[model samples]
Target: MNILFLTLAKISTLKERGIYHDLMREFSSHNHNVYIVSPIERREGQKTTEKKEGNATFLNVKTLNIQKTNFIEKGISTLTIEKLFLNAIKKYFSKVKFDLVIYSTPPITFTGVIKYIKQRDNAKSYLLLKDIFPQNAVDMQMLSKKGVLYKYFRNKEKELYNISDKIGCMSEANVKFVLNHNSYISKDKVEINPNSIDLQLVTDVSEENKKKIREKYQIPYNRKVFIYGGNLGRPQGIDFLIETLQAKSGDKDVFFVIVGSGTEYDKLKNWFDSFKPENALLFPAIPKSDYDLLVQSCDIGLIFLHKDFLIPNYPSRLLSYLEFKMPVLAATDSNTDIGTDIVKNNCGMAVHSDDIKSMINAIDTLKKMDGAKFEVLRQNSLNFLKKEFQVEQSYFKIIEA
Candidate 1:
């Protein structure tokens, strides 16, 4: 089978670890030809290129900056990407007949591209629904529900859905949301296919190495460390994150580590500069290998989402926390089932993003949890990851379709 994957994510190589990379690697390992088309954003200063390794072929198309840019550029990039991708696919993969076309959300502008391929090769289209779009923009108050932009994207969203032969949602809530909101989508077409990674054996950090890592980062060894490592953006509810840090300023037994960069980094940096909270440390995005070590050294993982989101955003960052066997503490909007799943599986605690009192209580609860019980949570985190988020599950789901 020849599989064509379309994404907005920058995929320079399959050597890197990510949800898409892991899934494509799974296909390649299974003796299927996997072709990926991803962006080389303007900010990257790279021309269009293609590379092949093993059974995987990568075609990176050049486009305007699609991520972490001003609204105007991001919008222009999103609007023009389909045409660019279609042209590239025609020029580079003209002879390949794709058996499956798997794409993810964020742009939802792939209807034209998918339509072209489906007609050209009679390929089956599969949507790996990761991000819900214009509605999420509205939830963040970035888009007006009554505006023309909203209507245009909303139409694009429907067209993308209508073109998809099957839709793989990240959670049950996602499936339900799509069915409830879009009456036209048949229930049989949607199922839960979540953000998964190619599982790797993680060696336990030695106590001495842990100490060295803590000393290197100026992290306290005695206190419980709670790390949040991912995009620092509006969708993450950065303001609430600041409020939580301020609330924990006086705590002596807990330390907070916030890492990652986005539009909201400057806002977080400004607050950190002004207040200089003793219990918290902030760093810009670090290398993935270093970040993984940092997560392994931490006692707990933290997830934050904006209170306004009606969309159930199950952040892939949760998978990282689980990968390192760290217990999770998620403060998210009520709509997402991520918090519910964490508590239900006995992996950790969850609270609404707006409730500072609950957040503090949950943190305190984890901070003081007994060793035996904490070990149970750690084990549970790994068990849940193996059960729900292995890349093989995602591979079989798409292949069986």
Candidate 2:
């Protein structure tokens, strides 16, 4: 089988670890020919290029900056990406007949590209629905529900959904949301297929190594460390995170580490500069290997989502926390089931993003937890990951489609 994957994520190589990379590698390892088409944003100063690594072929198409760019350019890039990708597929993979076409959401502009593949090779289309788009923009107040831009993307979203043979949502809430909102989509077509990764055996960091990491980062060894490592954008509800930090400023037994960069980094930076909170430390995005070590050294993992979101957003960062056997503390909108899942599995605690009192209390609870119980929560994190988020599960789901 020749599997074609289309994503907005920049995948320069299969050597890197990510949801898509792991899934594609699974296909490649199963003796399927996997072809991945991803972007090489103009900001990267790279041209369209193709590379073959084992059974997988990577075709990186050049386009306007699609991620972390200003609104105008981002919009233009989204609108034009389908055409760019279509042209690249025709030029580079003209002779290949794809058995399956798997794509994920964000731009919601892949209807044309998918339509072409379905017609050209009679390929089955599977949507790895990672995001609920224009509506999420409306939730963030970035897009007006009554505006033309919203209507256009909404139409695109419908087209993409309509064309997909199957839609793999991140959670039950996601499947329910799609069915409830889009009356036209059949229930049989949607299922829970989450953000999964190729599981790797992680060696527990030695106590001495953990101490070395804490010393290197200037983190206190006596205090429990709570780390949030991912996009610090509007969707993450950065303001609420700041409020939580301010509320915990006087705490002596717990330390907060916020890492990652995005549009909201400056806002967080400003607050950190002004308050100089003694209990917290702020760092911009670091290299992945270093970040992995940092996460391993932490006692707890933190997740935050904007209070306004109506979409059920399940961040992939939760998988990272689980992979490292760190208990989670998610502050999210009511719509997402991530918080619910965490608590139900006894992996950690969850609270609404707007509930500063609850968030603070949850933090305190974790901080005061005894060693044996804390270790149980950590083990639960890994257990949940293995059960729900392994790459083989995602591979079988797509292949069975």
Candidate 3:
């Protein structure tokens, strides 16, 4: 199968440690020809071009810095992606035929591009639903549900849903949310394809290596490490996380290590500015090698969502932690469907989204567990991923369908 992928993310001969790259490699290993059209976020001196690595060929399309645009202007940025990305795809693959077009969504404006390709080549288009929009905006109060803006984007979203050959959601709740919103989409065409963790990359290292990593990061030689790594954005509900740190600053044994950046990065950094959390350490996003090492250095993993996120996420970070044989502590609502496995497998605990007391208690519970119990949790987490989210088993079914 020849697959065409479209996204606004920077994919340099495939991204350093991204979910899409994992699936692409898996597909390519099976002898599927993989061609990707990605967008480059313009930097001061960066170059734009295509690079080939392994079986995957990467092309960087022209894209606007939507980060600098206003809300309405940024919303329109999606359309430009369709125009630029499709142009890049056609210029590169004009004579080649794509068996399938897998369009990942956030801006949700690629419906036009997908439609154009389907008409031009008579191909199947799959909507890989990463972030459900309009509602996610509503959850963050970025857009009002009853406002004129909501009605307009809502229509745009519905149109996209109707055009896709199949919609693959990140979680069951995400699938349910889309079904509830639109009457035209059939149940047969929608499927649950969770955000993935590359199972093959999972590793278990000795305590000696963990100690070296801790020392390298200036983390304590002996202490419990609770890691919260990923995008520092509105949907993540970071204010509550900030307040949790403020309330629990006295806990010296447990260190909360934060990594990654986003629009709300400045807001998160401001609180870390003067106060300088003794119980917390902040690092800008690291490379995949370092990220894998960092996860192993920690004793427990964390997932957080703001209380207001009506359609919350089942963060792929959870799977990454599990892959490293680390237990999880998630602060999120039942809507996310994250904790059921934790409870059943005894991997960790779950607490309410904004309840700092509960979060602290979950941390304490993890700290109290013996090494044997910790190992049990880690093993269970890895076992769960092998059983549930193997990229080949999961994505093949989606693509073959």
Candidate 4:
């Protein structure tokens, strides 16, 4: 079968290790011809380009900067992406007949593109529901529910859902949220298809090498390093993260590493400058290869979500921590099941994002855990990753639909 996948993520090649890349590679490995329509954001200085890696073809549509920009530009870019992508697809992929169409959510403006493929090729459409929008914007208070913008996107959201043959939600809560709110969506049409990655052999770092890594980063080798590496933005509740850091100012045994760039990077940098907490280190985003090595040296992986989120957000960053055999610590909103799943697997602990004391307590608990218990948690982390987040499972979920 020939498959067409759509995403806003700028995937340059199928070799990149990410959810979309890994999933498309899985389809290609199964002898399917996978074609991806991804954007080449303004920073890349490209008009429209096409490339192929093995069995997969990437059609890079030129697009405006959507992420890490001012609100006005971001909004304009988001609204315009669908038309740009649709035009690119028609120009480049006119001859190719797609058997399956899979796309993710962020901007739900892809109804026209999906409808075109479904009607032109009689393709089965699948919505990889990574995000629930407009309402999420409302939850963050980014947009007023009564505003015209909100109404427009909300209508687009429903149209996208209505066009999908299946809606693969990231968690049970997400599945429930969509069905309960949409009312028009069939219960059976939605299913749990969580964030997943293709498993790779993670190298084991020797104690000597680990020590060198810590020394290179000025991190203490004796302390347990807790690292948070991903987008640092509003949805992550950056203010609460600063408050938590300030609350744990005197702690000497636990080390913190915050890495990643976003609109909130300056806010975090300002806090780091003002406090200069000896236990924490801040850095901008690093290469994926380097980040993986850093994860291997860390003892704990950290996840944060805003307490205001009504939508259940499952961050894909958790998989990297698990792949590195590090137990996780997720401080998230009540609605998200990420924290619950981590604790249930006996791999880590989850605390409500608003509760700084509880987060500090979780750190204390990690510091007190014995070697035997830590090993169990480490093993549990890897086991859970293999069972729940393997990309092959997601491949089957889509193809079988």
Task: Give the C-alpha lDDT of model 4.
Answer: 0.92
- lDDT ranking, best first: 2, 1, 4, 3
Candidate 4 local lDDT, 213-294, one digit each (tens): 9888989999989999999999999988898888877998888999999999999999999889999999999999889888
Please state every model's RMSD to the true fold in angstroms: 0.8, 0.9, 2.0, 0.9
Would you list the C-alpha lDDT of every candidate in the order shown? 0.94, 0.95, 0.78, 0.92
Candidate 3 to truth, TM: 0.94
| The 10-residue segment with the lowest total lDDT in model 3 | 39-48
Backbone atom clashes (below 3 Å) for every candidate: 0, 0, 0, 0
What 10-residue stretch in candidate 2 is worst by lDDT? Answer: 66-75
Q: What lDDT score is found at residue 12 in candidate 1? A: 68
| Model 2 lDDT, residue 194, Cα | 98
Model 1 worst lDDT run, 10 consecutive residues: 66-75
- Mind giving the per-residue lDDT tens digits that candidate 2 earns over 1-401? 99999999988788989898898888989999989999999988989999999989999999999887767888899999999999999999999999999999887999999999999999999999999989999998889999999999999999999999999999999999999999999999999999999989998999999999999999999999999999988999999999999999999999999999988999999999999999999999998889999999999999999999999999999999999999999999999999999999999999999999999999999999999999999999999999999999988998887
Error of 4 at 36 (Å): 0.7
Clashing pairs in 3: none
What residue pairs are clashing in model 1? none
The positional error of residue 113 in candidate 4, measured at the CA in angstroms, is: 0.4
Off by over 4 Å in 3: 44-48, 66-73
**Error of model 2, residue 16, in angstroms:** 1.2
After superposition, candidate 2 runs with Cα above 4 Å error: none
lDDT of 3 by residue, 3-42 (tens): 8887765676644556887777777778878888777765
Candidate 2 residue pairs in backbone clash: none
